[model samples]
Target: METLDKLFEDTLRDIYYAEKAILKNLPKMARKANSTELASAFETHIEETEGQVERLEQIFEMIGKSPRGKRCPAIDGLAEEAGEIMQEAKDDMVRDAGMLAAAQAVEHYEISRYGTLAAWAEKLGLSDAVPLLQATLEEEKLTDQKLTELAVSEINVEAGNAAEKNETNKPRAPKKVAAK
Candidate 1:
């Protein structure tokens, strides 16, 4: 039977890959964000992600394992979909909304993963790693909450207004050029 330590190590590698992938992708998300607040949020999270990566490295040291990443397909797919959102959204406000949604998806994924890792660490009696995992978990939750606030307070309303304006200004189908 695979031991809990083995499972923990496997999960650590998964999140290590996820954090590295997020570090790579956050800059693009920041550049594409339409709202100043959204862009700043992405930039700030990049720093936080860097710290999270360092924490993962620390966890590897505590566990006597070399810090390395395993391919995490979930994060890869999420990042890919975020790219698609940028391409598909024509309106700036709507694009910002999409970016926020994409960011939340990432945060939610991290929160879930970190929460699981923390639980596993605790169960495995890896007392030292538990605090580190919990710290990242809390940060992910806070980031998710911030995205929620931004969406409700600004981005969603702006997107709705933009969509409304687009509908209002839509050119009427060239009045049926009735064939003579």
Candidate 2:
């Protein structure tokens, strides 16, 4: 059986790797975002991610382990999908909406992973890890909320309006073809 320290170390490394991976990917995501608000959110989160990395290092110190990461394939795959979504989206608002969806996916994953880690920490009596994970979980939730707010207030509505404008701009088929 894995010791409590081992499980805690494993989870910490998982999140550390995930955070580093996000640091690499977020700049690209921020660049691809259509709304300034979305871009700004990504930018802000990138900064938060940097701090999260530092916090993970602190956790490593608390646990008396070297600060390092195990490869997090989950975050890698999610980042890949986010890149693909940006490439495939048709227009600015659609792209922004897609970005929101991708960001939300990331947030949800982090929430689940952190929540599990927090529970495990508490179960194992790793009091130090619980607060760190909880803090990260809260940040992820807040990021998701901000993205949802952006989607409702701007991106989705803009996409709808753009669709309506496109429809209005299209030339209607002439009625005289029946005579021929």
Candidate 3:
């Protein structure tokens, strides 16, 4: 019979893997982003992510376990989707929009994972672990909020305008109305 302690450890490993995976991918996302702001966001996240990993390691030490990670399919799929956006969206504005969306997806995933881990730590009476997890959770939320502000302020509108302009430039087929 597995206990809450085992489940807590397993969840910890999952987010640990996810944060490490994110660190590897953030650089590519930064390079691919057409927006200077978007690129900077990714770059800043890389540093913050490094700190988040260290915090996770601290939690592991607190519980007397080695810092390790299990494979996380959620993050893998999100990273793959982001790669597809970079490859598929040719226009700078359109690509920025896609990249921003991809980043938000990742932030949402991390927010959920960290929030749950913090709650579980509290439940399992691992009081020391809760604050570290919560801190990371707050960072994830702030990242998500920043992405939302960027999307609303610039990316989405620019992408939409580009699409609209392109559509207007294209030849439209004439519609035939019969039996009026």
Candidate 4:
């Protein structure tokens, strides 16, 4: 069985990879977003992700290990799906909704990873690392909540309206001619 310390280190590398991937992808997401607020949110998160990466580096230093990332397939898959959603969606409102959903998916993944790492750090008595992990975890949770609020407040309703408009604009069957 892998020791808890080893597991913690492995997870750290995974999240480190994820954060770097996110930094590269956020600009695309921001550009694809229809709402200015949504775009701004993505932009803001990019800076926050930068900080998270630095925090991960600090954790590595605390443990006397080099700061580097291993392959994190889960983040790769999620990012691919998010990109697909942006490309596939044509309507602005609908695309915004899709982007919000995709972002929330990423945030949720980060939250889970950070939470686990923090717990593992605590269990391994790496008390110094716990606070760093917990801070990232909290930021992930807050970002998720903000995405939820944005979806509920505007994006979802706008998408619904767009769907309704499309349905209303569809061609209808011709009416029968009147019989004399």
Candidate 5:
């Protein structure tokens, strides 16, 4: 049987580690994003992440655990994959599209973790942790919705047009010259 403390500590480690990785990754993501909207989104999230770190510290203090981060290999891999997408994407709109997708991936991870933590906090009767984690979770969800809105409202259409143009520009096989 796992003690509540162990579960809570593990959850704290997961979020703490994820936030640290996010701090490193968001700047690169902002750089890669094409649209002002996308760039702003990344930049805003960077600020939010800083606040999240502070909140985590408060949670740690409440829990009697010194604030610390454990290694989050999952986020490391996800950030690497997003970087590769940025490198491979050609057009500005296409890159923005990829950026939105990557951002959503990150948001989903955060939502899942935060949701779990909130549930665990409630189960463990850690009322204080519940509100703290819930706040972060709400932000994660809102960010995800903004990314989706960006994708559907503009980025996807622009990328689609750019892709179509590239397809049209490709040299058609030399039209069969009628060998009279």
Candidate 6:
């Protein structure tokens, strides 16, 4: 007999897997973004995502489970879609637009998962997990909003206003990071 408690744990593991998958994918997305604003947003989200992963680990502790991830096909698919956008779009602004949409897709998926996990946690009487899940949920929603704002305020304007010149279509050289 399947119980909500079991369902909750499964969902938790799914999100844990998704977050880890997202961590691996974000740097690639950041490098591939032509818009500095979009790239910077990806970089910032990496830190927020690190915090989200920590919260997921804490929730696992409350449930007496080790921090482990079940394979999440949804995240895998989203990552594949992002990769496709990176590969297919040759124009800088075009790539930026596609990447922006792909990123928001990831955020939307995360928001949905976190919302469900938080609601289930509360219903299951896991008070400790609720706050942790809710915190990540809020972060996901905020990231989604910021992405929207970025697209509207900068990327769209840049895309629309870019001159019809060869220079506008060229790929950018990524900033060299200092090795720690």
By TM-score, the best candidate is 3
Tell me the tens digit of each residue's lDDT in model 2 across 11-104.
7898889888889989998998878888999999999889778878887887789999999888888888888888987878877777788778
- Model 1 RMSD in angstroms: 3.7
CA lDDT of every candidate: 0.94, 0.85, 0.93, 0.92, 0.88, 0.90
TM-score of each: 0.93, 0.86, 0.97, 0.93, 0.91, 0.88
> Model 5: per-residue lDDT, tens digit, 1-180?
278779778878887998999899889989877788889999999999999889899989988999888888888888888888899987889888887888788899999999988998899888988999999999999999988988899889889999999989999787787887
For all predictions, the C-alpha RMSD in Å is: 3.7, 3.5, 1.1, 3.5, 3.1, 11.5
lDDT for predicted candidate 2 compared with the true structure: 0.85
Name the regions of candidate 6 deviating beyond 4 angstroms: 161-180
Misplaced by over 4 Å in model 3 are: none
Better of 3 and 5 by TM-score: 3
The candidate scoring highest on lDDT is 1
lDDT of 1 by residue, 1-180 (tens): 289899899999999999999999999989999899999999999999999999999999999999999999999999999999999999999999998999899999999999999999999999999999999999999999999999999999999999999989988776666798
Assess candidate 3 and give its TM-score to the true structure: 0.97
| TM-score winner between candidates 4 and 5 | 4
Give the per-residue lDDT digits (tens) of candidate 4, residues 60-175: 99999999999999999999998888989999999899889988999999999999999889888889989999999999999999999999999999999999999899998989
The order of the candidates by lDDT, greatest first, is: 1, 3, 4, 6, 5, 2
lDDT of 1 at 90: 93
Instruction: Write down the TM-score for model 4.
Output: 0.93
